[model samples]
Target: MGTKIPISVLVVIHTPDLRVLLLERADHPGFWQSVTGSVDGADEPLAETCRREVLEETGIDSAAHVLTDWQLQNRYEIYPHWRHRYPEGVTHNVEHVFGLMVPDAVPVTLAPREHLAFAWLPWQEAAGRCFSWSNAEAIRSLPARAAAW
Candidate 1:
């Protein structure tokens, strides 16, 4: 595969009642977070990346939900283990944040290679469980975002 784009999307999938969905990484076992993936190509839109990752990772058709781009972006150093996926010397990534609101906690079909398991937890608990700081911050912001939605 070619080197991945440094741009990515972090999608917070949650219910109207503040229950957020968390996915366990197949590669990391216990490391859990929201649906996240790099853009498939340099020309792809971040929102499209968000939608695609949500479906590819959790089987959630985000097009059907209220997928709102929070207009938030976070740039962080790529973890050493995952840096190999990007171009040589590219050590950071810019992740656009989005929120996909479903009516309630819903069953999900995990993509076996990407995710090993899934859970819907209260927003507070979900935030606490996220492995990435950026992912957790997005979950922590869910309550206010949902309140305004």
Candidate 2:
């Protein structure tokens, strides 16, 4: 397998009403977070990667939604169990932030191998439920970020 890139995109899918979308990780059933995926290759810009990941993982057409690049990034250690996906000696990843604003909470088709189910929850509750500290941090910052827009 190719070396996993140390960069990723985390897209917080939410509506103007503050309903946030959360997807349960397939590998860790109860662990939930926003839409996320690694950048496919160096050739793809991060914004494109965000759009692609949202569509691939949740069947959400990013172009149709308002996808905002939040201009934020989180550098975190790779989870021990997931370190195998990275190249030897790689220890950290940089996850860029984005947000997809839909009109309302809607059903999503989770990619079976990556995610099991989905829910739309209030931002405060969603922030508290995310498994990753960085993911939770993003959700927690959403209100302020949205306000800036």
Candidate 3:
């Protein structure tokens, strides 16, 4: 695989009622997270990256929903086990946050190679189940964030 960019998007897909969608990683059976992926190229817009990831990972077209760039960003260390996907010496990542609000909790088609299963749960429970701290933190912010939307 080619080296991935150290910058990425973390999209919290949720319903108007605050139910969040979580996908279980194929590489790590029980590890769950929101829709995420690196920017395809340096020139790609972050909003496009966010929409692309949501569609690619969960088959949900973010453009059809109320996709909002929360303008929140988090810098976090790349997990040791997954660091090899990036260039050598890349130990951290910058994640841009976004929120995709659908009308309700709906079915999702998981990209089998990237995710094994999926679930829609209350935002609090979804936050608790996320494997990444940033993902969890984003989920935890859903209520307040949605309120401002």
lDDT digits (tens) for residues 1-149 of candidate 2? 23889899999999997889999999888999899889889888998999899988999888988988888989999888888888888889999998899998866888999999899999999999998888899889888877887
The TM-score measured for candidate 3 stands at: 0.95
Top candidate (lDDT):
3
**Full-model lDDT, candidate 1:** 0.89
Error of 2 at 57 (Å): 0.9
Ranking by lDDT: 3, 2, 1
What value does the lDDT take at residue 72 in candidate 2?
90
Per-residue lDDT for 33-141 in model 3, tens only? 9999999999999999998889899888877888888899999998888888998899999999998999998779999999999999999999999989999999999
The C-alpha lDDT values of all candidates are 0.89, 0.90, 0.91
Worst 10-residue lDDT window for candidate 1 reads: 140-149
Q: Model 3 scores what on Cα lDDT?
A: 0.91
What is every candidate's alpha-carbon RMSD to the true fold?
Answer: 1.3, 1.2, 1.3
Instruction: Name model 3 segments beyond 4 Å from true.
Output: none
Candidate 2's C-alpha runs over 4 A off are: none
